[model samples]
Target: MSAAPSLPVRALAALGRPVIAAARATLELWGVLIGTLAGIIRSYGKGGRRPRGAVVAQMYAIGNRSLVFVAVTLGFIGMVMMYQACLQFSRAIGDLSQVGLQFLRLVVSDFGPTLTAMMLATRVGAGIAAEIGSMKVTEQLDALRMSGVLPIDYLLVPRFLASIVMTVALTILGAAIMYGAGGLTAWLSFGVNPRTFFDPAMVQPRHLALGLVKAVTYGAAIPIVSGFCGLRARGSSEGVGWATTAAVVGSSFAVIALDFALSVGALWLFGGDL
Candidate 1:
């Protein structure tokens, strides 16, 4: 046999493994995304049939079920943020006139969609992964494959469609609650007038567009990432558990990454106006 490798060689090999694994995972994710897109296109083609009421069911599962959790979380966050801003203004600037204006602009353009997506990444992502991963581990996915069905079409497409709609709706609801709660806190805690605290004059059309775009992008990402993790599950129940955890982490990371990229692009496109 050949001599064993040196310590440096072993260390280099270990370092290279993770790099290669990351590259492979990235390519696999892109493949899943492409396959999902293809499945969507195919669904619109001749002889393509989607399950009845599937999209609506998913919408209820993803959106309606999440309403109270999202609303309460955002409401409390808004109150705390407004209180902090008022306190800082009282101590330093002594003028709180622009606080609500700036806060509303930030919420519409960033916080509302980003925070809402983060919450969904944990709840929705885990659910998708758990369900699909269980199916995978039980060989149900293989059965579907044998039946001439594309797994992405049957499994992920409805979710993709529903997520896009629900994410946008939730973002809108969350933003409204956040703003309303913040205004209430500002009035009660700082004696600011509701008329001044509820102003939306500073939010431009571009802000609305950016937020919508981000919400849609995040919605698309979560299902794709979660499904990919699910399909990759191995072994038994433990594999499903691992996939669930990975789905949550991956979905959350995708939201943050997409948020950063979209924000930068928006800033570049709109320049000083943004």
Candidate 2:
């Protein structure tokens, strides 16, 4: 009979554990959000050390290491789009001569940049979150603060700058490869000449503009998502794993969501062909 009272106590404890956990998660998320914002502000305000060298180092790490991954992924993306489009177009329309045009219209305006961005997000966003989260867990962030170094200026700003640059550059490369490489394959497969593939009149300035926009949006998304997750990391190896997964998933969703918004805006502002 006494066990009945003990059961209720245990039940309450179990329920209370979950509620406390939920509160803690909410607090952690908010803390990270706030901390990231503060970091951004601090990055902008940093002026010491006669212009810090840390930004350069960070740029090298974030931008340079990421370039090869972006390029290789985008190259394969180009091949896939070309191969798929060729298959579909040949079956339906027999307009193989228009392959370059088709590639430009679809890949340049949308898929190439978006896919490339998502790939970069997967590679870089998770990495950043894990690296930073691990750093935070190990107290490296605190060590930086103790040394009187503004961590954001030294850490986050470089990542922000590098990611934006990398995204834009990689997107441009991806679009080119998709259009150029895809066009070449189309030409070779269907007996079309090189002139059809290289003609400048086939490309649209508006689509190019849209590609750049996608790249910039993607660039902005990766670091912010990564930084957010990194800041939010707490407890155990499981927490680091969770943060990495969240960073990748969150950044991917943000990239896709932003791409859609950009596509719509581009289409509306620049016309349907965009």
Candidate 3:
């Protein structure tokens, strides 16, 4: 056997391991995304049929199940946010007038979709990973492959389609709840007029477009990342647990990174108008 490596060499190896792993994971994620897109395209092609009612089932699982959770969370967040904004304005500018307008714009362009996606990343991502990971460890995925089925097409495509639709719908619902709750808090706590606190004048069409784009992108990302993690699961239950944790972390990170990149691109494209 060769001599053991030195401390410096060992440290370098340790550092390089994670870097290599990260690069590999990134490439794998891109593959999963591309495969998912191809699956979607193929499903819509001639003589192609998706699993019966699969998309709707997934929609109910991803969207309907998440409604109350999203609403309550966003409502309280909005209330707290508005209270803080009013307090700051009272202390600094002594003007609560523009707070709602600015808050609405921010929510529409960023907070609404981003926050909703973050919440779903935890709930939906873990579920997807755990389910698929369980199947993976049981060799169910292998069984599917043996049966002449593409796992990405049968498993991921429905979730992908459902997530996109539900994410957008939930984002709209969450944004509305957030804004409405914020306005209520401002009125009750700060004596601000409801009319002034609920103004939508400052929210532009670009803000709407940006929020829609972000919602759709986030929706697409969560399922693909989670499914990829699931497909890679090994061992037994422990592997499923690991995949679940990774899916949550990875999906959340994707949302944040995508948010940053999209926001920067929007800012660049729209300039000061954004």
Q: Rank the candidates by lDDT, best first.
A: 3, 1, 2
Find the 10 residues in a row with the least total lDDT in model 1: 44-53
Per-prediction count of colliding residue pairs? 0, 0, 0
Q: What is the lDDT of residue 139 in candidate 2?
A: 85
Structural RMSD, model 3: 1.4
What is the C-alpha local distance difference test score of each model? 0.94, 0.74, 0.95
lDDT of 2: 0.74
When 1 and 2 are scored with lDDT, the better candidate is 1
Off by over 4 Å in 3: 1-11
Q: Runs in model 1 with CA error above 4 Å?
A: none
Residue lDDT tens for model 2, 130-237: 988887788888999999876555566667767787777777776677667666666666655767755556567787778777887788778877877876788867
Summarize candidate 3's per-residue lDDT along 103-195 as a digit string, tens digits. 999999999999999999999999999999999999999999999989899899999999999999999999999999999999999999999
Q: How many backbone clashes does candidate 3 have?
A: 0
Candidate numbers sorted by TM-score from highest down? 1, 3, 2
Q: Considering only N, C-alpha and C atoms within 3 Å, which residue pairs clash in candidate 3?
A: none
RMSD of each: 1.0, 4.6, 1.4
